[model samples]
Target: MAVGGLDLAKYCSSYDFNSNDVKSCSRAVDLTEACNWQKQRDDLEGVYKSADLHSGICLDPKGKDVGGIDDMLGFCRQKFKRTLDVRASDADGKDWRCVMDIDKDVVCIWQYSDKSLTAVQENGLWVCRRPADAASP
Candidate 1:
């Protein structure tokens, strides 16, 4: 499935992820698709719009980097759960809010609109800074 301008499975394979794990994440991504993959919308609607209403899931491989699409796909394959509304940030203090729970204590997907980057939170660290240079949050 594709979201945020990325084809989840394709991205993972392009990075040479494990075949089994890729399939796993593909399944997870499929589930997420059933519920509609994440999109940075301006409207604050639905349960996901509010972090308080969301829950989390467990991640596989225990401590994978989760800083890239491959790692995210690997993490998602283990469990498909809703993202928690954890207030996360980046080094520059940009609001990189947690958008999805790839896995527990593994990796979390974060969106920093103000910074124009989609970062990955691994053990509280933000990785994969993309869409560089933003003008708003």
Candidate 2:
């Protein structure tokens, strides 16, 4: 199954992240963006254009209607585990470990040497000891 002209066959024969394609093509496309609708529609649309395909909406790997943005996000979350890891260092020499969720949203936070949170994403800015981090702004 191919979504937006992406040969998901290399990723999976089906849309479920449990398929072999997940292991095969996870590096090709951010499975997170391919899965998330609200945050990725424009980006996905660009891929669609490059492929000379226009479906108006992003399709699931299996070519089924994803219904809506919320539904698509939920479906991907339910199907895939956190599939991305990114690391960096802060200006103060603190380490930052960032994990990209199934939805391609980066949950990044500065950590102490032992890996304890020193600052977290809060309303688009990094703040110390904050809860309820918002998506990148």
Candidate 3:
């Protein structure tokens, strides 16, 4: 709903989408935004809960650096022992650690050395990238 930047009432007022169809899309948007927010919050909170999380990358279902997203997530359970809910953004070949607000879902991303990362956002989106596991050594 908030992410789509569209509302059913407003969409129906315009003639492009049928009022009935608009409800489905609006609901989809609402669900997506809710899911995204939920996942990201969980992932960050999981990391924050761990004293051991900072030593290496936490490979999560949503933030894999390669492959199509669906396939990426499939590898998640095998490669890492945990699943954390998080939103998706597209990027590869970068790394970060994060200090997160468990309550608000806001994350402050940082590099391995604890310096901040330059957020390479597109439009209004921000993504978290982790160092290549092979490259970390």
Top model number, lDDT: 2
Please rank every candidate by lDDT, starting with the best. 2, 1, 3
What are the lDDT figures for the candidates, one per model?
0.28, 0.30, 0.26
Clashing pairs in 1: 114-136, 114-137
For every candidate in turn, the CA RMSD to the true structure comes to 19.6, 18.2, 21.7
Q: For residues 1-137, what per-residue lDDT tens digits would candidate 3 score against the true structure?
A: 01112233332223222222311211111222222343543332112223332222223456542211232232322222232332221222121211111211122121122123223334655333333332321
Candidate 1, 21-90: lDDT as tens digits: 2112222232222122232222222222223223222222443221212233333433333323222212
Q: Please give the lDDT score for candidate 2.
A: 0.30
Measure candidate 3: CA RMSD: 21.7
lDDT of 2 by residue, 64-106 (tens): 5543333433434433444333211122222111212121111
- Any runs in candidate 3 off by more than 4 Å, and if so which? 1-70, 86-89, 92-137
Distance (Å) between predicted and true CA of 118, model 1?
Answer: 1.8
Better of 2 and 3 by TM-score: 2
> What TM-score goes with each of the models?
0.17, 0.18, 0.15
